[model samples]
Target: MCILFVALEAHPEYPLIICANRDEFHHRPTEAAHFWPKQNRLLAGKDLEAGGTWLGVNQNGLIAGLTNIRDPELIQSDMKSRGELVLKALINDGIDESWLARYSPFYNPFNLLYGDEKALYCFDSRAKRLNQLTAGFHSISNGALDDIWPKMSRGTQAIQAHITNNSNPCIDSLLAIMKDGTQAPDADLPQTGVSLEWERHLSSIYIQHQEYGTRSTSIILKDKRGKVQFSEVRYDGKGRNLGRNDFSF
Candidate 1:
């Protein structure tokens, strides 16, 4: 996923709330979020081209999401796809410090978040570091954890408001916030080695570019009773809504 705003144990009824937008090249092949045909324990969208997933959650309440670090110089086409990291975490018991240290060097630079029902962990391949997240709200985009990008900040605030004000959070409101396409002011944009035009285009939470932009938006909510709801809205190359998928566990 490209942008993620998560609230962990921030509500009495809901223990996990996630609002994320997955950005990808419009032409890349993908399938909507669902239980894998054979591996039914895992629920996630499939990157058909790479045979891996950008995010996923298993029946045991283990969740994982990934975002590529924005460093064009470090990216290598021949390296392994970062989506494998999500699959690895979903099937494995857990990724510890030593596990991260041993395997991270082989993959392209990335930021990965994975954990079980009680705790969460973050690993950045570029930094070769791992951290456990405490309870509360947090955001991550194509940068370091909690990077002050306009979209990430606004998304966090939106999620926090939903959790604090309403006992039963409205999924539509969260989806609307994730659909926000507002660009930050010129002076506020971060210089991530991209042209001003490209930077402005990518600043919005919901990007709309012809070749590369947000391909789908997903909202996942998990209650304390072990009920999980996942909803995803797919978009086409021109930003047209293709379809939506909703699954529960």
Candidate 2:
């Protein structure tokens, strides 16, 4: 997943809102938001190619998303399948940040987002080091440090500002550098780079997908009773429903 925007109990109306975009090669294997027939548990898109999911959620409002750290040099794939990382974190028995960090998942330098009723936190494992982002609101893309990627830096600022300045609705912001092979100028982004392009078409504010190549968008709304209502927007992105289905859980 490249670009993402998420709100974790950061607002009064909607406690958890996640909007993200996943960019990858056409050959990469992916399963959009749905209840896995074999597992019977709802999951975000899974990368059957890499064996990990970009994002997923359960019925109880347990949400988790993962983004890979891309570099010029290819990182050797470990024997442990990356797909298991999503199943490991998202299927947790509901743990806190401190507890989640200790998972020691298969991949290092991973950008992970995990949350339940109590709270949510973003984690970074750059250079094989893991750290829990301090509570409050945060965003991440792909880079050496937080808020450093060209477009992603702006996305981080937007997330904090939208969360701190407004609370009526809540802002959804998530960003990552992607090699989509299509270059376009974006308002949120001043200019586009050759290595990574700023793609607004792939961006979402409230988990709505309707354009080509866009797979699924999921949103979570938490009420004062500490309950959550989850919904998903799924599509073929090429304007075809095909066999696509969106499920919340």
Candidate 3:
């Protein structure tokens, strides 16, 4: 997942709301969101290449998502696939900070967001720090949790405004916010070790490119009654919709 917006206890009807966009190469093989046949309790899309998921939720209300840290210099070709972190988090009884701390070094830099509705935490592999999120709105991207990158700030404000205006927000409204393609001003772009052209291409909330861009958007809502609604929409490199999947449990 490239970017994720989280709202905890900020909505009257839903206690937890998550909207995330998975940005990757168009050629990567992926499976749409579904209840894994092997692990029926898990709901998520699979990265066929890595044999893992980017975001997922289990039968017991546990949620986990991951984002790569934008530090190209620290990436090692032999490092473990970060996608497995999400699966590990979902299948395990609960998050073990010590386990993460011990194994994080084996993988590339990343930020792991995992927990239940009652509480959520972010583990920063680069910094090796674990933080428990407070009740409010937050955004995470290729940097640390709640880093004020231009896209992160823009998306965060847009979702907060939508929630504040609509008493009961719908999946379409949240998906619209994630579809924003407006790029940030050149002066507002953060220097993340990429070319200026590449930076500009990735500045928008919804990236559009012939090679690397947003591949899917996932929205998850958990109500006060403990019921969950999960939705995922897939897209091509040209930003054309491929298909959508919805599940409730």
Candidate 4:
């Protein structure tokens, strides 16, 4: 989604593990996480209008998510349609790090992740860039290529520090994203030099639409052992978790 941190080829046992918080406005009609009865696949939710999903992982080790390139004036009623990104990614066959660069499909300025348990590659469509992170430490946020995309360089680095110090259990990095820091991401912005508050908060990492928003979170774990596990959940108003679903590919 918008604010996503990826652990690519870092763990000795998994190829990639992703932890992200998909942010959006409070109003959007969405379905809960469930196994698609017709497709027999696990997904966060389906856009009834388009038969697409917000985020999903199939048994083929394919993982995909979406986020909008934030521009307030972009009030276009229909944005290339992110829902299509989620659904098309999983079922498609011609997707890889190299193929992504040439993929001219339509979607909000977003990112895509797909790999097994050995190596990982990420493509940020907004910048038209592709990166393969070092096996030991890796991450990604919204902005073009900045440390403050997450608005928490310290938090991200703090987790990296823990991962290096211990280095045994990579779970520490995943925990950092899930936990809230004592001081919000703002206090450390100055240390990051030009990390602006409004920019980070309203950063195009998250997006909203008239009837729908990506108010969900997803995590995909692929250990070095070639085992892939993932979790996708969607939430609604009142902070009610509509449901949670998990699957391994």
Candidate 5:
């Protein structure tokens, strides 16, 4: 997942609302969101190359998503796949602070967001920090949590506006926000070791590079009744919408 914005306990009817986009190289093989056959309770898109996932949820009401830290300097080929982190958290119902602390050191720098129905947590490997997010709105990208990157701020603000104006929040509005392709002004772009051109390209919530870009946009909503609505819209390498899947539980 390259970008994610979550609203927690913000709406009376819904306890959690999430909008996210998963970015990757165009050629990487991936499967759209679905129930994992091996782990019958799990729902997520599979990273065929690594046998893991970027985001997922289980019937136990556990949700997990991950984003890579933009640190080319710290990346090592031998490090474990960060996608595995999301899968591990979803697979084990007993994962806790101790579990994250013990195993976090093995992977490359990453930002992991995971939680049960009651609470949400974020772990930043670069800072070696873990935070239990309070009830409100939070956003995460390739940087620190809620760091106010232009894209994160835009997404959160859009969500706030939608929730304030509409009683029944729909996935279409959230997906529209995620589909925005407007690039940030050059001055507002975050310098994350990539070239200025690349930074400008990634500034938009929806990335459209020929080689590496957003592969899918996922919106997940969990209400107080334990019902979950999940939708994923996929795209081809050139930014053309491929198809979409919707499921409710």
Candidate 6:
């Protein structure tokens, strides 16, 4: 997941709300969100190339999502896939900080958000820090948790406003916010070592590109009653909708 907006206990009706967009190369093989055949309790989209998921939730209300840190200088071609972290987190009882501390170096720098409905935490692999998220609005992108990048700020505000105004926010409404394609002004863009042109292309909440862009948007909502709803909408290289999947348990 390239960007994720989370509202933990910030909504009156829902205690947990997550809206995220996964950006990647258009040609990578993927599967839509579903109950994994080998792990039926897990629901998430699969990255076929790496055999892991970018985001997933299990039957116990445990949730996990990942985003790569945007420093190209730190990338290692042979590093392990960061996607596997999400799988390990969902299946485990809870995040084992010591275990993660020991193994994080094998993977590229990343931000892993993992927790159950009662609590949420974000582990910054680059800094080797674990943050226990308080009850409030939070946004995580290619930077540390709640960094003020333009796109991050814009998306965080958008979701906060939507939830504050609507007592009963719908899935389509939340998904629409994630569809925003407004790019940040050139002066407002962060210098993340990418070419200016490439930075501009990725400055929006919803990226539009033929090669690398947002391939899917996922929304997860858990109400006060402990019921959960998971939804995903897929897109192609040209930014056209392919299909959608929705599940509740």
Candidate lDDT values, in order? 0.87, 0.51, 0.93, 0.54, 0.89, 0.93
lDDT of 1: 0.87
Between 2 and 6, whose lDDT is larger?
Answer: 6
Name the better of 1 and 2 by TM-score. 1
Instruction: Write one digit per residue (lDDT tens) for candidate 1, span 1-249.
Output: 789888988999998888889999988999889899788889999999989999888988888999988888887777888898899898774667788788877777888999855888888778888877778998989989989998889888878987899989988888888989999999999888789999999999999999999999998899999898888898876778999888888
Query: Relative to the unseen true structure, what is the Cα RMSD of model 2?
Result: 6.3
The lDDT, on a scale of 0 to 1, for candidate 2 is 0.51
Name the lDDT of candidate 6: 0.93
Q: Clash number for every model?
A: 0, 17, 0, 9, 0, 0
Model 4 regions lying over 4 Å from their true place: 41-44, 73-75, 94-106, 117-119, 145-147, 150-155, 158-176, 179-214, 233-243
For residue 157, model 4's alpha carbon misses the true position, in angstroms, by 3.1
RMSD of 5: 1.1
lDDT of 5 by residue, 1-249 (tens): 799888899888888888899999989999999999989899999999998899888897778999998988888899889898898889985356776778877898899999955878999988878888888888999999999789888888888899868889989988998999889999999989999999998999999988999999999999999899999999988889999999899
In candidate 6 the C-alpha lDDT for residue 199 amounts to 89
The lDDT of model 5 is 0.89
Q: What's each prediction's TM-score?
A: 0.97, 0.64, 0.98, 0.69, 0.97, 0.98
Candidate 2 residues lying further than 4 Å off, grouped into runs, are 77-79, 94-108, 128-130, 133-135, 153-217, 226-249
RMSD of candidates 1 onward, in order: 1.1, 6.3, 0.8, 5.2, 1.1, 0.8
* Model 5 stretches with alpha carbons more than 4 Å out: none
lDDT of 6 by residue, 141-175 (tens): 99889989999999899899999899888899989
lDDT of 2 at 79: 37
Residue-level lDDT of model 2, residues 8-77, one tens digit each, is 5666656565655554544455666656666555556666666567777765567777665554353555
Ranked by TM-score, the better of candidates 1 and 5 is 5
Clashing pairs for predicted structure model 6, backbone only: none
